[model samples]
Target: MEQTQSLVLVITTVETASDAGVLSRALVGLSLAACVQIDGPITSHYRWAGEVQQSSEFRLMIKSSLSAWPELRDQIAKLHPYDEPEIIMTFIDDSSEGYRNWVIDQTT
Candidate 1:
């Protein structure tokens, strides 16, 4: 049996909502992502440069196909502000049929 390709949700955080909007637009415009949802001014606590740090950040949930992953990663690397931006990918194991089809149609 052949393995099936599924959608992925790419998550990242930025300092401001404006950055989220900019990055989201670029991703969609370039066909790198089908949809991008921005959420938060949520609190983040993490270690950076060996120092513990805390900050408010906006999170971006980007929806795209697995095939687009590489270019999407590259694009985020180019556009993200943090020296080491939080770019994480999670495979979407299941979703509504309509929504899944929409994602596939939206992304190349």
Candidate 2:
């Protein structure tokens, strides 16, 4: 079996489902992500600008390799509407080898 490349699941939330769709397509089109899974109107409650706020958001789980993170992050920032968008990355170092390779291959 070939060595597995590091895979990452980048998370970001948008106010509307339409925004999620657009961002997902753009990332995949740019080869920044292999696949983007869009999930739900999740509730988010947090403090921002010294105020506690709540919002209904659509979350995107972007699958990509570690090598693509920097460009992907910048692209997300450029496209996201929120002033302080939540862009988080979680490394899936324990992921199945086949899946990891697939994500890397698709991104490349």
Candidate 3:
């Protein structure tokens, strides 16, 4: 039996809502992502270039297909304002039938 590809969750954080909106719109507009959910004003604490850093950020959780990874990544890199943007990815083993099918349909 062949395995079916499921939906994927791509998470990233940006410094501002405008940045989040820009990325969201660009990804969806370019068909790189089926949908992008923005939520936050969360505080992030991390180390950057050997220094401790802290900041308030908004998060974007993008829904896309596994097959769309390469194009999505490239598009985010080209369009993201950050020199090193946070791009975290997790494969969703399962999801709602309606949502999963909707994601595939939108991307297609």
Candidate 1 lDDT, tens digit per residue, 7-85?
Answer: 8999999999999999999999999899999999999999888999999999999999888888999999999988889
Worst 10 residues of 2 by lDDT: 1-10
The number of clashing residue pairs in model 1 is 0
Query: Distance from true position, residue 38, model 2, in Å?
Result: 1.1
Worst-scoring 10-residue span by lDDT in model 1: 1-10
For every model in order, what is the number of clashing pairs? 0, 0, 0
Residue pairs that clash (backbone atoms under 3 angstroms), model 2 = none
Ten-residue segment with the worst summed lDDT in candidate 3? 1-10
lDDT of each: 0.89, 0.90, 0.86
Q: RMSD of each candidate?
A: 1.6, 2.1, 1.6
What is the per-residue lDDT of model 3 for residues 15-100, given as tens digits with 9 covering 90 to 100? 99999998899999988799999999999999999999999999999999887777888888888888998788888888888888
Identify the superior model by TM-score, candidate 1 or candidate 3: 1
Per-residue lDDT over 81-107 for candidate 2, one digit per residue giving the tens place of the 0 to 100 score: 889889999887577878887888887
- Once model 3 is optimally superposed onto the true structure by TM-score, how far is the C-alpha of residue 93 displaced, in angstroms? 0.6
